[model samples]
Target: AKVVASPIELCQFNGISRRDKTAQQKPMIEVISSTDFQVLSCINQIKQNMFLQFPERRLIQYDCGKLQTLDVLLAQLKREKHRCLIFTQMTKMLDILELFLNYHGYTYVRLDGTTQIVQRQMLMERFNSDEKIFVFILSTRAGGIGVNLTGADTVIFYDSDWNPTMDAQAQDRCHRIGQTKDVHIYRLISKNTVEENILKKANQKRLLGDLTIDGGSFDVNYFKKNNIRDLFDQSSTLEDIVRERNEYQQKLDTSRTTIAVAATKTTTTTTITNSSNPDSNLTLTQYEEALAAVEDETDRRAADELNKEVRNE
Candidate 1:
């Protein structure tokens, strides 16, 4: 019988990104007997499934759909001589990924909170110089900043951070100034799960970033809502999640377009007021044309799928 693996749903937290702190740490034997997956059963199931699928030469069930897609992407990218940087939030998840890499005979280097500061630089240097190393598995926070890994051209977000900027910083590791090849970044988000909601909230925060960059006076409180219960509750169906994502995107796009128009008008007004020349109707007309073009592009994009990222395999 075939086992369909679901993407491991990580716990949602406010402010700091961390694993369940209240979870009791226990021996393997104790954990095995416990039904609490928060401790170790989740990773155990993944390893068990990997062995189950070993004889078939197909690593289809890796206890998560994200890993299945990564399995295919890794194989294809390796053949093309493209190195990869895989980022996940939890170090335990890194351990699970390492197990998968070892089982598949893929050479990799890992860095997380446990790695010594002196050894972290050494590992980075080794991964950068060694063309034989196919992947660099890293915990998102530890490897996210103050590291340059230009050797790899592809990046995969095994799981996204609650804060969008953290994920963005992690992505910049491979897409920085020293990189030559076109960098490709992928974020794996499980559909119809808590991850979908997390992504939506993250996107909203990103939109706030865009607004701040555009010099729009938008209150950060606009995105905040008393919806924590909705985020963790799994009663929402697939259609409900999709609709929410699309509706939210449309609203965000509309707000962006409005902000753009306001900024354009403000700029045009300031220029007209300061300039000695009065025939600045041309400038206003030009701004109107640019705004129209932006609106048209936004409309075109709004018609497309909201969640372009793939769900669990």
Candidate 2:
């Protein structure tokens, strides 16, 4: 299971955490530098730091961005006729993707915060019955957990969630008790940004969850006198433990990135020599070469990510 995000700086990120907001300060400054738009969306001046508002606003266009990542993945899935679950934290993200998927002619069902609890089951049942419905769009927090849709053999996180546990639960929507085929999970992360850091943190949290639940035996200190206090003393408070754990996790993630990059390093560029037409430059072979180069880059990145997953295991 993985956490995914399509980062193209397309959305007005609302209610961002202080740490992440601070990390994106430079990009926000760039946006301010380029445009004359003053943010007016946040009511309280002091509290309105995370969002950028303008008189007229536009998200980064879908092509050549994260949507392109989805296009490639979804195409292969369509060829195999594999059912899919596409999960995102934001309904607005779902709205945009719905448009993209519909334009591509995929039949899909959706569930979000607005869907009533009573109607949720009915929608899931509808999706389950119709094999022709190839996709399910779900808001991760609202409808990801407890809903069983084993029809889909693929689970994709359109964006990462702050809570690692929620992301894991979202994956379980497809990897449920009665699934017959092997499930494939893809987390589409933007390269070289705060989004990458965020995913590292989430994966570390996932590792912690695994350590807590996994393993064969408990430590001797767990049986010591003042057992409850001893437990608290061993790690301090739960909050403190989490804080210390995250502080230690950063070092581990650094090394993991080093290993992943080392193991999956590949050439992503090629020199195309076209001398067929002296007068003009554009040709079918050249166009195909450009597309292949883009695909090669995408595949290289995916392979690198898969290597990371293997190491994580």
Candidate 3:
């Protein structure tokens, strides 16, 4: 199951974190930099003093919700003696994670785009041979392809990729042959962000693939061009998505029940007609009429039941 980790920025501020906000607002300061030299100079001096006191404090936000969630998850996985592979898209994130692991005293091996090809193989071998290594940190694009890390049973996606298949390929590392354990996969998604939409789109793509492979009927326009805009839509919350899914499921269930009842009724009617008149033959038109009648009856009955429930509510 994909576990969404609500990032601290989105959770605490109800928006992007302070650091991100500051970055966005920093560039605008250039426009007014010369106009207020004295005030800017004073502010810069104070900011420098604060930075000196707390070096890289703003750079390394160790107190985020996602990291907090990761800490707890790692602790639990540690207790179970499980080895984990943590994959992130950015190499900079790997640097932060390395510091985090170091702070927590976790024995981990890392691989990213910067690492040499020879070093990559050696690191993989060492991780596979060494039982002391608790975690393997990797850059998703660099570590996603052409390497096997079956030594780890747990995979954590620190961030999602635009192409879902990249994440799937990364997961296939542990799921390869010679793996004895049941692999657990976790995907951390920031709430009310583009990550949520990315996940939904990934799921839709996977569903489309499954349908195509299984010879299921689907609309050709299901992947229409206009639907691409949904990836950037952040207006819908996770709760809204969950509620919509539940409603869709309920409707699907009701539809299945109605179809089943209609089919049974039509079959019974056909059987009775055949039994009552030995010489009677049911034509295709008659069969269609009977099916249509039962479908209408079933729909009416289902609607009445729904109306009664609504009244009771």
The TM-scores of all predictions, comma-separated, are 0.58, 0.49, 0.57
Give the alpha carbon lDDT tens digit for every residue of 28-67 in model 1. Answer: 5576667565547688888889777553333433567988
Report lDDT (Cα) of residue 153, candidate 1. 94
Cand. 1 TM to true fold: 0.58
lDDT of 2 by residue, 1-313 (tens): 8955444232334556556766889788888866644444334563544333321112323544678878888999999999999988666777777777767888998887677657889988888888999899987766623588888899998877644776776898788898899999988766554455455545554554443212223221111122212323332333443576677677667745654464466433322233443444444345334434654343334334433544576
Prediction RMSDs, each to the true structure: 23.5, 29.6, 24.9
lDDT of 3 by residue, 1-313 (tens): 9966667745455667767777878888975786689788999999999887655633444557788789889999999999999998666678789878887889999887666668988998899889899999986666523478889999999888655666887899889988888999998888988778767765555543442212223332333333456767888777775676566556656755765566655543211122333343544345334434654443334334433544576
Error of 1 at 265 (Å): 10
Which ranges of candidate 2 are over 4 A from the true structure?
1-64, 213-313
RMSD of 2: 29.6
* TM-score result, candidate 3: 0.57
Clashes of each: 0, 0, 0
Worst 10 residues of 2 by lDDT: 220-229
Q: What is the C-alpha lDDT of each candidate?
A: 0.68, 0.64, 0.70
